[model samples]
Target: MVLDTVMTTLHVLVGALWVGSVVFVAGAILPAAVEGALDAAPLEKIADRLVYLSRGSSVVMFLTGGHLAGTRYTIETLTGTGRGHLVLAMLALWLALAALVEVGRSRLVDGLQEKRVRTPAAEVTTVFRVAAVVGILLLVDAGLLASGLALY
Candidate 1:
């Protein structure tokens, strides 16, 4: 019971951090940088920092989520239950989020590091917009899963 509670808490907290960072980057930071409200140097720095933070959160989510699934659920429960389906959906979403972040980091951060020139606003915007949409979906899915309504 204690392990259950601890793993659940860790999963939720890390998930929130991951989603929140994506939203902030995509919605606020990227837009501000694009519109010239924020400086490019600082924006790049923020993105660099978030790359590590986001990766760390993803690792935590995977660990805690795996533990919860392994301990609390059986193959029958995972395949037969509504919550099981939700868990599967959430896993898919998590994979998508991971891919999107990796692509964004490679394109946005790598470009910045390799070339001293500022990354094009349009490129940043495009990458971040996709990531933001996925991030929002993750949050909504999490909400539904938590409420036990994800499969309904």
Candidate 2:
């Protein structure tokens, strides 16, 4: 029971951070930059800080979420069970993670570092658009799973 409580707490906290940060970055921060309302250098700096924050939160979510699901929930329940919501939530998480790593870290960073973008304005806008969409999806997924409404 104690372990259950601890794990639940960890899972909830991590999930909230993971989801909330993504939402804030995507919905609030990105839009401002994309609209050219924010300066490019400041936006880039914010993006860097957001990346760092996301890394830490994602790591915690991955670790705690794995433990919670693996220890508290059966594999059958997660996959084969009639829990379609859980399945969808899991799939969304996976997709979000993929977007973060492949698109955000690798592709976005590579483009930025290589000076592939015609201007800092263009690059910032591009990154903001992609991150905003992906981040919003990730947040929704985590929020659903964390709420326990995803279970069968």
Candidate 3:
């Protein structure tokens, strides 16, 4: 029970951190940089930290979510129920979110290598926005699962 609580807490916290950071970068930081309000140096630092956070949070989510799912479900159940499908959808959303982040970051990194802020920010803005959307979907999926909506 204690382990369950701890794992759940970590899962929720890290997921929030990951999603929220993505939203912030996409909505606030990127816009500012593109508008020439923020500099490339700070943007680079933010990108660096975001990459670490994204990688770490992805690992943490996989571990905690795996433990939770393993305890709560079997292969048969996961493959054959509404809740199971929701879990599967969440997994898909999670992978999509991660990939979007990686792609955006890579573009930003390559653009940064050219020492241009607005262009890189402009380049990756759409990718990050899509990631933000996926993150939002992931959060909504979690909410549905938590609200017992998936039990239908």
TM-score of each: 0.85, 0.64, 0.97
Candidate 3, residues 1-152, lDDT tens digits: the string is 99999998999899999999999999999999999997777888899889889999999999999999999888888899888888889899999999999999989988887889999999899999999999999999899888996784
- Segments of candidate 2 deviating more than 4 angstroms: 84-88, 91-98, 101-151
Better of 1 and 2 by lDDT: 1
Q: How would you encode candidate 2's per-residue C-alpha lDDT over 33-124 as one tens digit per residue?
A: 44657654555566576677667766666676676666766766776654544644765764565456334434444444544333443444
Best by lDDT: 3
Query: What ranking emerges by lDDT with the best candidate at the front?
Result: 3, 1, 2
Candidate 3: clashing pairs of residues:
none
lDDT (tens digit, per residue) of candidate 1 on 87-114: 8878888888887877776677655664
Segments in model 3 whose C-alpha atoms lie over 4 Å from true places: none
Q: Name the candidate that leads on TM-score.
A: 3
Error of 1 at 7 (Å): 1.2
Q: Give the Cα error of residue 25 in candidate 3, in Å.
A: 0.3
lDDT of 1: 0.77
